[model samples]
Target: MSQLYVAVLAIIVAVLLAVALYRATRVKTKADYLVAGRSLPAAVLVLTLLTSWIGAGSLFAGAENAYKNGFAALWQPAGGWLGLLLIYFIAPRARKFAQFTLPDLLEARYNQTARVLGTLAILFAYVGITSYQFKGGGDVLHLIFPDTVSSQLGTYIIALFVIVTTALAGMSSVAYMDVAIGSLVTCICIISAPSLLHQAGGWSALHSSLPPQYFEIFGNYRLSPHGVLQSPAMGLVRALEFLVPTMLLMLGNQVMYQKFFSAKSERDARNSVIGWIIGTVVLETLIVAIAVFGRALYPTGEVAQHPREIIPYTARHGLPAILGAVLLGAVFAKVISTASNYLFSPATNLVNDVFVRYLAPNASNKRVLIVSRLAVVLLGCWALYQAIYAESILQKMLWAYTIYSAALTPVVLAAFYSKRVTAWGAVAAIASGTVVTLAWDLPGVKSLFPHIISDRDAIFPALFVAIAALIIVSLFTPAPSEAQLAQVAE
Candidate 1:
């Protein structure tokens, strides 16, 4: 029966790779490889964005949250929903200001220094993101073939697959394959949710099976690691801590903007947000419901230790063979899609923003494309190295989000909205936000500090320093000239 599951997964992957092989031929130029030659329609844009955003972070990390907290686990995605509302307004503008990468946007609006620093920040955060995707793909494989494939070996296999597929056709392969992967995952999850509910003895059983706290906004009690009762205000802060990272990630996600840049028109980019918002809410909600339903049936055992495995576990054990295979394959494909997107984004930053822009500005399209492929291989190796020492995907997701949100989001947003912001201000914001987040998380530095700051995650302190520096430094420094402002405005 498990062999049946593995066979179905192998078939789906083969079909996806074949499709990628076909798309690889269409990629001929730097723009073609990087942004699909800005040719994607709104429908393609919507699905790719959906697939990229909901990868392992939302599927596994978020499922783990729902497995523990039930409905209130929505705090993780509610942040993205908040971010999406703002994204609706920013989407068209991003498409209009079209560039290859986030660092391109930074350099246009700020300076070369901002571009270099922005690339550094993106590499740190995006590689961490890609690492977890490898971990997630490995987890799914291990669940299906627990005896045959160790999780570490599974990670290496997934990493190589993602790197090859991404390097084969770049965004062309990633975006189009996402169309199939996204639709399959969404349909399977929606269908499985009701079936799982029925098998678990329906909604009432799920409610009774879990703690009442699981139903609450922040859950019933917010206790410290020491088990002391925390104030409600502090609990809300903790919830915000979860919420803000998703919100910030969505707002500053280079992956989203790159997809937008790939759109055929600004209108296509703007319109896709509508579909993306709908898909995310429905699919993410179903993911939580699926995990919660799984918890009702498989409450104990390995799922407790590795809560992130709940979704795949439910698909294999709780669903019928065919439905289980479909669900598992969908989850696996999504992880691959997301890993490709994250893995590819920083490669673009290193190649387009750093290598070509600085090192070989006069390089031909052919040379640029070769460097891009090499960049993917090198970065993919780095991400896989991180996967070897993998921890909780949820912890890693927030850490990556904190770095991007605090360090880059403020400056990225200011570039479009404020002509008053100076290049030095952007530099200060980027540097301070990144340094604070990194320093706050360092073991030695954290050990030396007081609990109030060190005990907390990096989001608040990093954001505070970043935003403050942006405003204060901008006020004190010279504003950008008309030429500089117009670069972003147009």
Candidate 2:
């Protein structure tokens, strides 16, 4: 059975690489490499968006949330859903403002300093996000072949594959490869959810087997880092912790914006968001359901110890051999797809935002392409290092999400909507948000303000400071000139 699973995963990965190699042939220029030459149609955009959005964060971190808190895990993805509503309006506008990277938009709307700061913040958040995808892939591989492949060895293998695939073709490869992977994962999850529920003896059995709070809106309790159970009120706070960061990340996600920039037309970008919203909501809900049902079937043992592995564990132990193999393969491929997207994104930032923008503005397309792939390899190594030392996927996901959410989201949204926002104001916001989020997790910092800042997640304090800086600073500074405002005007 383990061999069967390995065979299935190898086939899936082979197909993915073959597609990537084929796409690599078409990536001759920077635009082709970074934004698919801005020629992706709506369908490709939709699937890539879906694939990019649902990765290790949803499959591993989110599944862990569902395994522990049940349906309340929906709060995490609910943020993305809400953000999608606004993104529908922003998509066409983003397409109009099409550029290779998010930092390009930041510079246009704010200043050079803002662009540099934004790039740094993106690297901090994206590298952490990418690290977990490596970790998640390692988890899947270890589950399939535990004796032969330790999780640590598996992490290195997954990182190599992700780096190679991403370096092969860039966005054209990532976007087209996602079409196949997104379809496979969506179909598998849809099928797996009902099948797993039936195996758990349906909703009635699930209710009887699990605590009632599992079905509640806010959930009844949450487990602290030390494994202590907290009150229902704390559960609601936990839900908000998940909800706010996820929403903010969605609103300001560079990967999503880059996809929009890749669309063939403004219409394609906007239309893709509708499909993206539908696919995201459906797939995320199914994932939570699958996790919950898996918990009902396997209430204890190894999975109980490492709840993050619920989906893959259920794939290996609970399902029929063929179905289990396919499901496991889907999870593995999803992690690779996600890692490719995220790993490619920050690499794009470094090359386009820093290398080309400053170091070699006159570099040839071929030279830029070479540098781009090098950036991918370097960042992939950095992400793998982070993956090696990472403890909890859920905690890391929140930490990364908070960094981007509190630091970039407010400023990104302001760039689109507010003409009153000044350049220094944006710069101040970015600096404060980044500093507060990074500092919030420090033992000494948390120890200094135990009650006020210690109990709260980083998002609250970071976001408050960021927003206040943006608003107050802008109010004191001179408003942007007509020319500056016109750059981001609808």
Candidate No. with top lDDT: 2
What's the TM-score of every candidate structure? Answer: 0.98, 0.98
Q: Each prediction's Cα lDDT score?
A: 0.91, 0.93
- Runs of candidate 1 with Cα error greater than 4 angstroms are 453-455
Clashing pairs in 1: none
Query: Model 1, clash count?
Result: 0
Superposed by TM-score, candidate 1 places the C-alpha of residue 226 at a distance from the truth, in angstroms, of: 3.3
Please provide the root mean square deviation of candidate 1 (C-alpha atoms, Å): 1.2
Model 2's TM-score against the true structure: 0.98
- For model 2 the local lDDT of residue 171 reads 95
